[model samples]
Target: MDHVPGGFALNPRFHRIAAVEVTEDDLGRAIPEHVIAQLDAHLGLLGTSTGYASGGWTAADFARMYQVVYAVLRDTGRRPGEVTSLHRDCLERVDGKPTLIYDNHKRRRHGRRLPVSESTAQLVETWQKELDALPAVPGCAQWLFPSPGQRNRPRRGHLNAAQFCNRIFRDWIDELIPDLVDEQLDENGAPLAYDRTQVVPYGFRHAYAQRHADAGTRPDVLRELMDHRSLDVTMGYYKVSLSRKQEAVRTVAALAVDRHGAARGFDDPLAYEVESVGVPYGGCTEPSNVKAGGGHCRIRFQCAGCDFYRPDPSYLPALEQQIADLRADKEAALAMEAADWVVRNLDDQIRAYSKSADEMRRKLDVLPAEERAAVESASRELRKARSAAAFVPLQALTARSPE
Candidate 1:
């Protein structure tokens, strides 16, 4: 077996176990006690291992990994890759609300708010507490799960690598529910029954969706909560069983029938008495002999044709002047605010860079004259390039252009 990067060995024939296909059956089978113990020990060593000096797995990494895989399994009836758009930061709490933020392969962040189940919330809370207790490693502050051997730089966090950690969790689930691997074949030669007794890591998410349906959550709400771009996708993926769909249909049908029975005729006197009065049609004008004249009649509802119509040309100049003044004030305020914010942020960045540069210079000062001179020359060129750049002022950049 080839030595995997994080204290584990993989079959030599397989280039990477991380990319290997893991079926429910593969994960559902019983894992011996020794293997479980080994896995736990490995996870325990992740934070303290000096071998992972570059950066190693941290508690946050495990939490994030658990959430992503769980969401995929829950949101889609199937596992990962079956669902095309899984959020990367699938378990973030924003403004006291659970949100799922996805990053594209290019590392751009986009996200959606997720409606969390009580169980999922509890699990997340437990994980958050555990993560808060772990000490932050220097230089790995940005990483949710730091890897080993990364002392001075952030590690490239792997989504698939995190998912692979579910192997141990899956094993534990199988131990609790031994019948998970058992299957019954149907007439179509496909499995009619698949074991789903104990909750695996992925099962947490499945349970989430199921609970929502059981709670009689609306389909549109479910679609939004699950962060599905299309309602059809949500229906196809998360709407697992026919029984749930039938229940939803029945509920909607009952509501429709009730609405139909309760509806009143348009001419009902009681309805008119109860409802708020709307604008009277034609506004107190007789229905007959309506002509364009001194009467309530004009050319297509014009003042000449209708008594209610009145021209207001006198307010035009005043309105325009008011709008112009308001626009000028708005522009000035926006410009000032933008300029202030930019200056503050820029000052912060400048201070940080200056501190880094001073530290570098101090380190070089200890070196011989030739090395120090070379470093100083490089620094001077960098400063010149930065100063000469065509960066526009922040206010000018954000200012609206004249139409």
Candidate 2:
């Protein structure tokens, strides 16, 4: 089959079941008014139920299925190999709430508990309710949802597999949101359609990340919540910065302020003028780091040379105290940047040591009896280099005289 944009084979079965081939108009068309109404009702029920319904799924059965899969992904973020390890103990009831306990693969421990976010927790609550409401299939646990089988027995355990859920998601998208489907060509010029639902996954994670970003959550907090090991991974791999979103909010807020002032005919022309000037750049009016003998500081708010600079003299003593509070933030940011760089460099050194060790082992395997001593000496030198590098940071710290 030709690969679809999102990534599943276009299930021929959906075309038969849905009994309709979506045309280009259908693909590009807005969701029908009836569908919108149905969605509203579904959302209302889902909000009351807990959070189990799939965000995009229109049918109750499909929504329940997607909810279950989403819960699994939100809990583990694992490939198939780790799914079986997700048991009841892997979850917890904290403060009278049910929560997942994420195993830290890097730490190799279950004690590293990662609580489900509020949104995800809400979803799980609704899903659990929905799942409970479903009629139990014969030969299955009370919690099991009905499957498409003769006796409605629980679907095969493999149904929980990442690949399987991915496939199902693709098929569901192809059947319900046909416009999302696309075609690809094979080497023989044969056309095939694949499902790409997995590519975007209905933008749930995007929406989740966006909510925190919009609320001005710190990047570090976002990284931790997103389970990203690095801030760069969270910022670069996930999405754009929160600043852009804040800018959007600022734009709307500015207009609202203007509208309110205009309605009362209490216009502050100076305020408009200030707004027109916008934020200043570089060190034009503020105290420049240049005067401090430090290289030109790029700290936006701290730069005395910046045109947008407002001095402490302009503010009351109480306000000046508030401004002084920002010094801690500046120091913290600088420290975080320094620590991140140190960690990255240490990681690189560790990787290099591992590579060198592997090479030395290979050389030792092939060394002749006479050359064995020389090979062993080279290995010892490599180990010494690695050990010395480990102590370099500590040595540098001790070498520093009183500040």
Candidate 3:
């Protein structure tokens, strides 16, 4: 930010921070990739393990307690409190997929159940049976995660979330992950070399967001799934590891392929020759019509929404973003009692972009679907030809012609 008085910048005193204020990556406690991988590795080994000591039911219960809680938080993105207080019958199907319906302590929307992966649901089922057979909590015996002492009336009645977070994570999880056992950082995001404790259970939720982000889940959609009140909150943990970035790029590239071959007009929808003047939101058609640096525009609400400019539907992600932004604007207008003209304008722009999206699905008539397969096959062969390494005398190839 510029050091100027009353400047429009990310100075929190006057305004909110930038789109990404601070991400998990910026923090020191961002769980390392190996940590999550280790958790996964442990869970995998746990699945086929029947080496429970014959009379050591206590040890088996302890294992179930650890795994089930870990799995629930991993899959459902529930807080530790929600996970601990979860009932045995909290399992159910939502939209044909297994879901966990529990009180959302942070929000009032318990009706919006968190969808659980099939593996998680299976673990929950197994734990449920084990829990039912053993004993219930003193007051609520049906608690999925009840204390062993509940039946014997000793100590606390249910699984202590604080204990799980503070002690068990350090004791069990740390020993399980030797590489990270001694990793810690001070307040300055610097490593605390002398410290031997690093991993925490809360990072699992951040890990979940990172996983979805790595999978290329859109920010808005992820925010809804994470049940965050703001996109800023969701983005705090959405920045993922470098490997996930590579994976996301590959996934997007795969989407650009048609049945025949590489998607025709995959980069641009306008297929016509036009000098693109890159703008903040999109490209400008009438660059000559504006001034330099921060150019001028007759209607500059949005570059994509401009009449003089053409938007690319092949840019599916950006098109989707525009649609989402327009919807948000429309909602805001309605809520703020803005004039009908403003709402109508937003609606019209949304519909227009939506039409562009439809056209993109048609691939801008690049090659007719029936003719595309042959063209694509030939195109692939041609690409292979062009990509083939041309042979030259090895000496000549290696020799420098001039200094």
Candidate 4:
């Protein structure tokens, strides 16, 4: 109370350190790939005769631990607590595919069915068999990861997530510290040492979100997989790294098309961003318009009819939607007996957008299957990035007013 500004107020007179805010640049607590690999390698040996047996850790304990960690990583980054407390009958078949019937303890959501990879399902089945083979430990029949037998205590509970995190997982990470190094090179051209703090158990969940984000998973689809109720919460789990964004831009550049649907190629994909200005659903390449910040359009922003407008397959959905909206508007105008000029303008835009969409589709249909898949993947990433950034207002970010 003595440190309070007026001896009674909540505010203190001492220097107040503000909390660090999260930004787009923040990658959250996702573990580095190398460290994850080390963990996986060590965990893979569990259930085998050569698994870790020191520090009072038994083969059955190793098997249980492996299933808990491995399943979380493989199943879209489930919470460790959820995985640890999973009921013994968690595995079920849904729609002819192996599905995990687990509870979302954090969200109070129960019986959430998540489809697991074939290999993961097999692992779960194999663990069930192994558990059956073990000598019946009293009070452990109902828990998938029941607490191992203790000398004087009742072994009637599941593995404690907090205990595992504080001791078992911590020790495992420490053991692999010497081998964990960043993929990026430092100023000396040597592999930088990885931070061990980043490989915490919960970091696996962030890693799962990032793995999908890097692979160009749509935000809505990722949100569903994460069981998040809002895109904002789902997006918080991952950020597209700078390197991944640049790679996507280069890949999508190869598929750019002009207003006429003719394939556009850039000799230097890196220069494409510098030489153009982004407009609605596409980019403008006219030098003057680009320099004037895309405001000096000679044709009054008729981007569909503009010669410099370049769009790729990434904008196909938007283009198609715009065309449909224009058609609907045209019908409404005709019913309302609107002006001839307004009707004509809408007709022109619909025709232009439709032509562009058809031409892009034609170009895409002719590409080899492998190239087409790669192009589609790259375009999805670009679209995902655009959708993620579209909602943030520039003025809201740049405004200097405290309010």
Q: Which prediction has the highest lDDT against the true structure?
A: 4
Location of the lowest summed lDDT over 10 successive residues in candidate 1: 252-261
* C-alpha lDDT (0 to 100) for residue 236 of candidate 2: 34
Native-vs-model 4 lDDT? Answer: 0.71
The TM-score of predicted model 2 comes to 0.37
- Against the hidden reference, what TM-scores do the models get? 0.32, 0.37, 0.49, 0.60
lDDT of 2 by residue, 10-58 (tens): 5453334532322311111222223333333433232122222322222
**Which candidate achieves the best TM-score against the true structure?**
4
Kindly indicate the candidate among 1 and 4 with the higher lDDT.
4
Per-model CA lDDT versus the true structure? 0.37, 0.38, 0.56, 0.71
Q: Each model's number of backbone clashes?
A: 22, 20, 2, 0
Model 3, CA-based lDDT: 0.56
Candidate 4 Cα errors over 4 Å, as ranges: 1-27, 44-64, 176-178, 237-381, 390-403
| Weakest lDDT window of 10 consecutive positions for candidate 4 | 394-403
How much is 118 displaced in model 3, in angstroms? Answer: 1.7
